[model samples]
Target: MKIHSIEAGNFKLDGGAMFGVVPKSLWQRTNPADSNNMIDMAARCLLVENGDRLTLIDTGMGNKQSEKFFGYYFMDHIYDLDSSLKKAGFSRDDITDVFLTHLHFDHCGGVIEKKKNDFYEPAFANSTFWTNKEHWKWAIEPNAREKASFLTENIKPIEESGQLNFIKQNSSFATQNEMDFDILFVDGHTEKMMIPHITIGDKTFVYMADLLPTAGHIPIPYVMGYDTRPLLTLDEKSKFLNEAATKGYYLILEHDPNNEIITVKHTEKGVRLDKSLTFNDLFN
Candidate 1:
């Protein structure tokens, strides 16, 4: 199996929002803010080439939103999805499965695109988009706090296309015959965000969707403010980090602008960042 780091694009978000209650004095040391107090974030996605199946995890924020809507977030360094896929030696049609960690706009917005008369359609027409049943329901009928992040234009088309499938949430190690990876479910960030635990050769790479957005968030208290239940996130992170440290799992970070992959170690202060490496470092 081969994995490629696909750069969808970069955008600006309020550092305070991204870092939560973590004081600017600390988080700013790693992710510095601009004059407007917004920090640069990457819509980094992963592409898995395993035998006959080509699976993509997360789609990033697509370019279908109006200028006014996008202006709020300061979307920049825009890399078109088709071009990125082409650079990776694949196209939209080559993707057989799209495993979405969650349905937030920044994560799944690129699944659909705007056509000539403003009609929206699935970007990867041949792909079977995957989302767990709980998350699918939570996203579609979003609560007031998360409603803005779950846009209908980015979601409804997949269901309308009849290619959407739900992974069974019966257990943390839910297995799908078609997928080589096992699903890890955590509810701290959203309802049932599925983190893919993929084994490639001798190493296991855990896709850190939002549970651990960046290495800076490695320290126990550095949870995101966007998380619905912050205390639950604390408990979840503690357990996951302990296991990740013990097993030496390579974490595939989705939003870290500078770092791509990292491994953690159990320190006196609890689990802390160990080493930051590139994707090639692991595969080479």
Candidate 2:
């Protein structure tokens, strides 16, 4: 199995929102903010190539939204999905499965594209989109707080295209033995957010979707404000970090601008950042 880091471009998000209760004095040290208090973020996706199945983790925010809508997020250095895929030596048609961690606009938006004047269609026509039934229901009928993040243009098209598939809603960890990966379902960030635990050779790479957005979040209390259940996040992070530290799992960060992969260590003050490494450092 081979894994490639696909860059869908960078955007800026409010630092305050990224780090929930952590003071700016603390988080700014790690993720420095701009004049507008927005910090640099990457829509970093992962491409898993195992045998004939090419699976993409997340698509990043697509280019279909209007300029006004995008301006709110301060999206800069935009890199569309198609170009990113091409650079990775593949194309949309090459994708066999799209495993969405959640259905937030920034994560799943690129799965569909603007077709005509108003029509939208799935970007990867041949790929089977994978999202859990629980997450699908939560996203489609989003609550007031998260409604803005779940855009119909990005979601309805997939169901309409007849390519949408749901992973079985298992209360326990769901192992897709066929795909050679297991999913760790987390609810702190969103309802039933599936974090892929992929084992390549001797190492296990856990995709830190929103569960642990960056290495800066390793300190346990640095949960994102966007998380619905912050206390649950704290509990989840504690358990996951301890296990990650024990097993030496390489964390694949999705939104971290600078750092890509990191491993944590069980410190005296709880789990803390150990070291940062690149993809080549692990696979090459």
Residue 150 C-alpha lDDT in model 2 = 91
CA lDDT, candidate 1, residue 130? 93
Per-model TM-score on C-alpha atoms? 0.95, 0.95
Model 2 residue 216 CA deviation in Å:
1.2
Error of 2 at 185 (Å): 0.5
lDDT (tens digit, per residue) of candidate 1 on 1-284: 78889988888888899889999999999889999999888888999887788899999998899998789888884676788899889999999989899999999999999999989999998999999888999999999999999998988898998999988975443233534587888999999988888886678899999999888889888988899988999999999999999999999999998899999999998998899999878777
Q: Which stretches of candidate 2 lie over 4 Å from their true place?
A: 171-179
Model 2: colliding residue pairs = none
Residue 47 in model 2: shift from native, Å?
Answer: 0.3
Stretches > 4 Å off in candidate 1? 170-179
| Sliding window of 10 residues with minimal summed lDDT for model 2 | 171-180
- lDDT on C-alpha atoms for all candidate structures: 0.88, 0.88
Root-mean-square deviation per candidate:
1.9, 1.9
| Backbone clashes in model 1, listed as residue pairs | none
